[model samples]
Target: MAPKITVIGTGYLGATHAAAMAELGFEVLGLDVVPEKIEMLAAGRVPMYEPGLEELLARHVAGLPGSTGRLRFTMDFAEVAEFGDVHFVCVNTPQKHNEYACDMSYVDAAFDSLAPLLTRPALVVGKSTVPVGSADRLARRLAELAPAGGDVELAWNPEFLREGFAVQDTLHPDRIVVGVREAGGSAEKLLREVYATPVAEGSPLVVTDFPTAELVKTAANSFLATKISFINAMAEVCEAAGGDVVKLAEAIGHDERIGAKFLRAGIGFGGGCLPKDIRAFMARAGELGADQALTFLREVDSINMRRRGHMVELAREAVGGSFLGKRVAVLGATFKPDSDDVRDSPALNVAGQVHLQGGQVTVYDPKGMDNARQVFPTLAYAASAAAAVAGADVVLHLTEWREFRELDPAELAGTVSVPLILDGRNALDAERWRAAGWTYRAMGRPRA
Candidate 1:
């Protein structure tokens, strides 16, 4: 018989995990403290926009795709403790207010609420990204809290699903890392069973000590952050040397040793993960008294931030120095395409900068307008890209959404007051826009 699984927390990670587990033929119950979240999930509507998450959830929750049983959602911890053989704590640990340290309160609360209910034998797995020493602390706490005490094992299984690709990444991960307290544990076996499809596809399964597993997530994010900053730093130098960073990245990316992924140079990196993870990693290093080793991340952070200011200055220049009374259209507001998540979004930051500089900036995004409104309500939002460009002096394409990429430069040139477009993301076709009777400017490109 398949082991019954309970997933605690129903945010992006937990919601997707619950749906995936049910799809894997396990009877799953998803739990959360928020009543509204549980209610929404039970009604078969995912609160956030993740591609294919809703379809998968509904298929399994309604017992459609050969499901052994339907998945359910509840706010009852006692029911979860009694029903599930294995529990997944998928809480979030966000960055604390005005500090580099992480706010672990959510993780602690999830464990505190559920650990005491594990009277019978069960395995409690952690999927939340946390500080290095967190797993050990939680393991000891779980042991003390449960009536079964040491019988209930604790394991750390960090998730690496990027937003917008969460469903596919979860269903078909590149590799699976399980941090167990000892060699040959049930945690690895259960996780293997949970990921049977990906395992069958030959995904590598690595088992390590608890601390190592905890550090794996932070280390991965920090390295990705470093990679993005590395290219942006090159972009700065390329700007000064009259060389194009895009061509340089393309040339260097051919070598398999440095295969291109996050090499695109633009306003720089931001999202729910990369920016805060590096800071939390730095804070953890400082707490461990090894701050000197990760000090270079500070430079990475600085370089990434400087790119934002540089783009603002570019916008200012495009609008003829002072932005007072200048009409500018800011295209795209989400940090990335196909995602509504805007936590520390670079596109919105650039839009806000133009607004602050007294430019009459009109912003438009395919899916991020609602979120952008919550973050920067002062900026003018347009109904569409055409509307945003209507009578504007210049257009700043900050986010590279597919719609923005496919925009007809001829149509946009006819709509705008001035035929000037600055490609902040380096994604636009300069030749196409120029041929359409508009002046196209892009970062890291030689000035026309």
Candidate 2:
């Protein structure tokens, strides 16, 4: 028989994981501390805008028409403990306030709340991207607090879900990694059974110890941050030498070792994961007396942040060197495209900077308007791309949404006061924009 699964803290990671687990034919109960999240998710509605998440929820969340009746949500810890055979702790570990350390309060709280209630044996799997050494520490604590003691085992199974592609990624993961203390024990056996479908479907199972599993997520994010900053650093050099960073990235990306992923030179990476994870990784390294090993990440972070300032300067230049009276149009609000998460978003950062510097800024995003507005309520938001760019002196395309790429540049050309566009993502078509009588400028490319 399949193990009944319970997911704690139904945020992006938890909610999606719960729904995906139900999709895999398991009886799943999801729990969150927030009543509102439970209420919303119980009704098959998502608070966040993730593509395919709501549809997936509606298909399985209990009480909905023609549903599988396999998924339910609640806010009670005892109910979760009694119901689930395997519990997944999916709480967030956000960065500490004004510090580089990870704030593990949520993870700690979820574990504390559930561990005391586990009177029976259960496998608690952590899927949050936390600092290294967290899993071992939590495991020891879990054993101490739970009445089941040795029977209540804890394992680390870090999530690698991308924002826009979370649903597909969860259901058809590229790999399934589980970190267990005893490799062939019941904990590992249970995990193997829980993920048997995906593992059997060809997603490789990487069975390692706790620290390695905990490090995978932070390490992957740091490496990605480095790759993105490396190209942006090249963009800086290209700007000085009158060379094209786009073409240069293409030339370098042809080397199979470097590959073409995360090579696009733009305003740099931002969202909930990369920035906080790298910072927390660095902070944890310092605690372990290996700070020098990850010291290079500081420069990588600097380069990434500098790109946002560069875009603001470029936008100011496009409007004649001052933003005092200029009407600026920001084409995107979320950090990247296809999701509504605006946490530490470069697009909103750039838009905020422009607004602070006295530009009458207007922002637009297909799905991120509400989240962006929550973070940056002062900035003007528009309903559409055309509405955003209307009567603006300069436009900044910060997020590379496919909607922005598919826009009719010829139609937009006649709308703005001055036909100027700065492509922060470097994903736009130059020929089309130029042919439409609009000035197209991107980082590291020669001016037209």
Candidate 3:
């Protein structure tokens, strides 16, 4: 018989994981403390916008018409402990307020709530991104708290899901890694069976010790953050020298060794993962007394943060020195396109900065308006791009949504008070905007 799966915590990671598990032919029960989120998911509605996630959820969530009915959700931990043989703890590990360390309070709470109710042999798999050596401590805690102390074992399996591409990433992962305390333990056997579908579909399964598994997530995020900052650093150099960073990136990306995935030079990276992961990694290294080895990550972080401020400066320059009383329209608010997540979003940061500088900033995003309003409530918001740019002195294209790319520069030019526009993401077509009687300016590109 196949092991029943339970996902603890139904936020972005947990909701996607639970839906994906159901798609893979497992009976999945997802638990969350938030009543509204649980109510939403139970009705086959995703709380936030992720491409294709709601449609995917609709196909599998229990009550929807023509659904598989394999997935169910609840707020009760007792029901979760009774129903699942394999529990995946997919709680968020956000950065602690005013500190570089990762906040493990959610992970701790999930374990505390579920451990004592484990009256049978089960595998508790941790899929949350955590500091290294956390699995060992959590394993000890589980043994101490659970009634079936020896029967309940722990496994560390950190997730690598990107916000926008979460569904595809989960269903067809590049690789599946599990960290086990004992070599060839029952935890390994059970996880193998749980992931047999993906394994059969050519995803490599790497079995390793706990520390390496945890490090894989942070190290990978740190490297990706470095790659983004490295290119943005080149953009800064390109701007000073009047050179095009796009051409530079394109030429360098031709080398097979340096593939062109995260090389897009823009307003830098921000969302739920990259920024916090690198900082937490640095903090963890400091705790383990290996801080110097990863000290360059500080510079990587610095470069990324500098890009956001640089965009703000560019906006001010476009509006003639100061933003005092200028009607500035921001074209996007989310960190990136295709998702509604605005946590640590660079676009919103720029919008907020411009707003603070007395620019009458009206922000618009296809899906991020609600979340953006919550984060930066005082900033002006608009229902559409045309509405945002109406009578605007200058416009800033901060997020590179496909809809923004599809927008007609001619139509937009007619709405703005001034025809000046700044492409923060470097994603817009400069020639088209320029031809439409708008001054198109972008970082690291020659002025037209």
Candidate 4:
């Protein structure tokens, strides 16, 4: 028989994992400490803005009309312990308040709460982005706490879900990596069974030790951050040399060695993962006495953050070198498109800095207004892009949403007090804006 699954921590990762598990034909029970989140998921609703998550829940959540009834939710550790044969701990490992290390308090609390209740043989899988040695330490902790002792095993199966494509990514992962106590152990066998559907569908499964699995997520994030910062550094060079970065990126991308993915340099990378993950990676490396090996990550962090200030300065320049008495319009607030997560969003950061410097800023996002407003309550928020740009001294395109790209610049030409625009993402069409009777400027591009 297939193992029944319980997903702990019903945040973005936990909720999506539970839903995807149910969709794969398993009986899934999702647990969260927060009663409200449990209640929301039990009612087939998601607390956060993830595309297709609510619909996935509606289809599988028990008691919903026309649902498969394979999924459920609870806040009780006792119920979770008795119900699941395989438990997935999907808690968050956020960066520490004042330090660069990851805060594992939530993950620890979840394990401590659930471990004692595992009186039967079961496998506990960790899916959090944690420090490399975390799984080895946690494996011992689980054995020490569980009454079943050796019967309860541990595996590190870190999550790699992109914000916008989480559902699809979970349902059909490109690769399924599992870190077990030993190769061909019961934990690995159980995980292989759980993922048999995807593996059969061609998702390669890489079985490894605990530390390798734990390092995969942070390592992947650090590499991506480096890529984004590398291109942004080239953008800085392009600006100084009067070279067109867009054309340069296009030319270099043809080599297939560079492969033009993160090459569209703009405001650099931001979000929950990239910024803090690299910092935490560096901190963890330092603790392992390998700080010198990862010193370049500090420069990567510096370059990414510098892009935000550069955009702010460009906006100030567009407004005659002073933000005071200037009405700045900001488009998009989330870190990237398709999700309403505003954690450390470069767009909101730029907007907040301008607002603090005496600029009257109005912001608009297609799906991120509520979350963005919560993060930047003092900044004015508009109902639509047109409303945000109306009566503005200079318009700033910060986040590159499809709605922003599809915006008719000609229609917006008559709204602003001054027809000057700055493309922080370098995603907008320069010719379209310039032909629409507006002076357009973007980083690393010549102002023809």
2 or 4, which is superior by lDDT? 2
Clashing pairs in 2: none
CA lDDT for candidate 1: 0.88
Models 1 onward score TM values of: 0.97, 0.99, 0.98, 0.99
* RMSD score of candidate 2 (Å): 0.7
Candidate 2 lDDT over residue span 309-369, tens digit each? 9999999888999999999999888878889999999999999999999999999999999
Count the clashes in each prediction: 0, 0, 0, 0
Off by over 4 Å in 4: none
Q: Write model 4 residue lDDT over 274-357, tens digit each, in one string.
A: 888999999999999999999999999999999999999889888899999999999989999999999999999999999999
- TM-score of model number 3: 0.98
lDDT of 3 by residue, 105-125 (tens): 999999999999999999999
Which residue pairs clash in candidate 3?
A: none
Cα displacement (Å) at residue 68, model 3: 1.8
Worst 10 residues of 2 by lDDT: 331-340
**lDDT tens digits, residue span 178-286, model 1:** 9998868777787777777788998888899999999999999988888888988888888899988999989999889988888888888888888888999999999
Count residue pairs with overlapping backbones in model 1. Answer: 0
